[model samples]
Target: MAEALREQQLCLSRFIRDPHSNPAPPGIEARRLAVYRQLFLGNMQSLLAGSFPVLSATLAQTQWQSLTTEFYACHRCKTPLFTEVAGEWVSYLETRSDLPGWVAELAHYEWIETVLLLSDNADPAHDPEGDLLDGVPLLSSLAMPLAYAWPVSHIGPDQLPLEAPVEPTLLLARRGADQKIHFARLAPLAHALLVSLQQQLLTGREHLDALAQRAGVERGALERQGIALLHGLKAQGVVLGTVRG
Candidate 1:
């Protein structure tokens, strides 16, 4: 009896997930199945649209519907939470070949805002008044440095590029004290600097010294400019502050 009930449930789920290909379970009315399919698909679309507003707006009406429908029918979402549906869709898009190559990157770019806003990571113990150059600076747990092949920030209905730029688009996404997510483009050097800071527990001067060696510039020259840049990032809440120790 349990096996039969489980099979029935699977059949119903398959039909709801892909009604076009999977027939309804035996004895279920077509009207009732239609309602179930509509409700499930509608909720999925709404959640995706809310999370990836730019991606939805970039695709045409039929294109958007087809994209959402295919994702709904084919992708087996690993997460049970509705909030994570966008991330699952982004992962799904990465595997798809029919869509534009940039689609996944753009979806990820859009979805990052949702990730930052919903992040539960708390600020680490640090001194907001500590010296940035002398003390090891701490990057906010919520700050992320993203690099993509396509210029995701510029892709929209009116500005889709057929070819990727020679240089990758580098972006820093961070949540401010006001609990709002902010995004900014980063120069290659700046991007490298932020990534180094995030990955290592190093003092600001040490980070800049390494950057200078790699960049083949005089340590004094880079240190002067890098110190100011770090301070600016601190003002923006990207640099949480120096470590307490």
Candidate 2:
């Protein structure tokens, strides 16, 4: 009896996962299987659609449907939570060869906003008014740096690029005190500085010196420019403040 039940479960699982290719278990009504398939796949489609609205908008309806169905059929999601399905979809894209090269990057960019929205990271304790150059700069726990090869930030239904740009896109997504998420395009220098700050090992002055050396500029001039940039980031709530030490 146990072996029979196990076989039945396996057959049902295969049918539900890929109804088009897999036959239903013996004695199961076709209509009943169809209802189950529709319910399960529809829910998955709706969840992914909500999570990746921009990707959905960029693709043709048939393409989107085909992509989602492929994901549903082949991707064994790592998490049972509905909120994480979009993340799973992003991962699934990495294994696919038929889709456009930019699709994965675009889906990941959309997923970052969802991740920031649901992040439980709290504001770090720091002096908001502290000097940015003199002390170590502390990046907000809610902000993240992202880089993409295909200008994922600019891609949409009307703005899809057929070829990758020469320069990669760098962006920062930061959640504000009001709980609103904001995205900012960053110059390569600004993005590198923010990444340095995130490491939490370098003081603001050290970062400036390192950046100056990389750019082969005078440290004093870079320090002046770096301070201005840090101040602007502080105003935008991306850099929380300087550490006491």
Candidate 3:
């Protein structure tokens, strides 16, 4: 009896997800089944549209509907929460080769703001006035360094690019103290530094010295410019001063 009930539930769910492919559950009214199918797919589309407005806007209405419908029918979402539905869609897009290659990257770029905003991680204890060079520079928990092949930050309804640029797009996505999410372009050096900071808990000067070595530049020259960059990051709240000793 339990197995039969489970099978019925699966049939109903599958049909609701893709009525065109999956047969309607036995003994259910066609009218009611259509309503259920519409409700489920419509809700998923609406939720994804909110999360990835840029992607939704860039695609034609039919394209967007078809994309969402395919995701609804084919993707297996691990989470039941509406907030996570966008992430699932992004993941699903990554696996799809039929779609444009830049589509997944664009979706990820737009979805980043949602990820940072929903994160419950509190800021780590740090000094707001400590020296960045002398002490360890602490990046805010909300700040994320992202590198993408597609120029996702620039892609929109009217500004889609046919091919990726020679240089990869590097971005810093951070949630500020005021609870606002912001994105900024990062230079190659800055991107590498932030990525290194994540991997190592070294002082700002030490990180710069290592960076200079890697770049085959004079340590003193790089230090001057690197220190200024570090200061600017602190000003933007990306570098939350220094780690509290």
CA lDDT scores, all candidates in order: 0.92, 0.88, 0.91
- Candidate 1 residue-wise lDDT, 178-203, digit = tens: 88888899988779899999899999
Positional deviation of residue 37's Cα in model 2 after best superposition, in angstroms: 0.7
Off by over 4 Å in 1: none
Candidate 1, TM-score vs. the true structure?
A: 0.92
Best by lDDT: 1
List TM-scores for all candidates, in order.
0.92, 0.91, 0.92
Model 3 scores a C-alpha lDDT of 0.91
Candidate 2 clashing pairs, residues 3+ apart or interchain: none
Which pairs of residues have clashing backbones in candidate 1?
A: none
Stretches of candidate 2 off by over 4 Å are none
The runs of at least 3 residues in candidate 3 whose Cα sits more than 4 Å from the true structure, single-residue gaps closed, are none
Which should have the higher lDDT, number 2 or number 3?
A: 3
- Candidate 3 versus truth, CA RMSD in Å, comes to 1.7
